[model samples]
Target: MQVFNVDKEKTLNAALLILNKLGQADYHKIFKILYFAEQQHLKNYGQPLTGDVYQAMPYGPVPSFLYDVFKASENQASPFSEALELSKAFTVSRKDKIPYVSPTREADIDQLAETNIEAIMASIEENYALTFKEITDKSHDSAWAKAEQATETEMSYLDIAESAEASPEILKYISLQAENHNLRIS
Candidate 1:
């Protein structure tokens, strides 16, 4: 759940790719996985899923940012439409910014998004390992209270760690909480 402030276009492209891949009717599965990851993260962190599940969840295919961008377009086209516009609106360089390599068809885009999702998940998993180490180190007092206090003092680390383990659907929530924690600390 590395919540970077990505560009709107990039986010939108990713969403469109996912929706197109999952297909309009069966897109819920992608959403469900991401959402579930976020829920699992919240449960682990003892936090509620109030906002921004993308940052909280694990896995890939979280579509909140993409959905926002898709909805914002003047034309409320479905993922298919948006993706079509995106294929034309953006250049190859910009498409690289998105997870999907090509925007030709639903299956092609879907496969690309799925691959990107796996990469994202792998990235989060690796980062989680590192963050977990940091948290464990900072809280290495051999006492539960000390660990809790340490994490509380620098909650972003803990929050991100929690989110890194989250399901994809709930990842946005995890990201939101982590961002809030970072803001407070900053």
Candidate 2:
């Protein structure tokens, strides 16, 4: 089994990078649950070490970093087996809670959501019970209109958010629009 060795800083950095790249919604939807526990693992491993390995050994190629870490930490006072156990539990919880989808399917859904904001909003309203008033107030209608014009052709929520920074009020509306459609911040 291969294990990846990572220090607390490196582990935390990697996770944060992934979170930033993935956006809040996708991070919450897919990465957060998996990661919060990982954060706990980092917290528990109090000292910096030469190496640590397979925080969890699920049925796959042990991440090289994990394998290296495990191998390096073999003689340490407290190796990563315990943390690996927790990670395993975390993985099991995730696997039992949600099924994995192919990367292609994931990308297709992401593209569709980005390009089809209206439909995405409709679905959000239906599924998450989102409300228009919850997102925008009367004061922001003018700004919203202006932003709407800019975004009439471009379907990216990230673009809309980028362009519509007239005020906090306007930003709220943009956020609501982007969030309703599951748009990632670009």
Candidate 3:
């Protein structure tokens, strides 16, 4: 199984970039849009931009570490919330009994490449207006199904690349990169 090590800082900043554009958005929208963005990045660049480890969740493929940070931030009453460094940059609050995430500060755009920003912005435009079911359905691809059906829920980068329709050559490159990374992605 090819797993990319989570880049916590880049992950937070990437999520922040989405939230910064959305002003405040439901986690469903945030995660779904980012899932597509991940596919786009994988297809275009053959490397991860946010570098989050994806997990097959009920809603879709959720970035494991990013979701943990969001959960911690949203549940401030929990002791874990205070321990999360990302809470300093992002805030999750409820309105109408629905959780919404907002950035405490602007996204550090420097962490993202021009192509990364372009992909994310395009994904946002494409997915932001979609309903919960619509977006959730969109994320239910072969990659997610492989993780969802397995004992371990972690998504494979190879599966993700395949689901993104990456060419054989790009897939080979990604496989080699993941192998060389040895699960320690930068």
Top candidate, metric TM-score: 3
Per-model TM values vs. the true structure: 0.31, 0.20, 0.90
lDDT of 3: 0.82
> Over 4 Å off in model 2, which ranges?
1-5, 24-51, 55-58, 62-96, 99-186
Tens digits of lDDT, candidate 1, 91-131: 22123233222233432333233434554343334332334
- Compared with the true structure, all predictions reach lDDT values of 0.37, 0.29, 0.82
Whole-structure CA lDDT of model 1: 0.37
Ranking of models by TM-score? 3, 1, 2
Q: For residues 18-65, could you state the per-residue lDDT of candidate 2 as single tens digits? A: 323333222122222222223222222311121223121122112234
Candidate 2 — what's its lDDT? 0.29
Which order, best to worst by lDDT?
3, 1, 2
Compare candidates 2 and 3 on lDDT and give the better one: 3
Where is the poorest 10-residue window by lDDT in model 1? 50-59
lDDT tens digits by residue: candidate 3, 24-127: 99888998888889888888788876778888988899887788788878765335543276776778888898888888999898888898889899999999
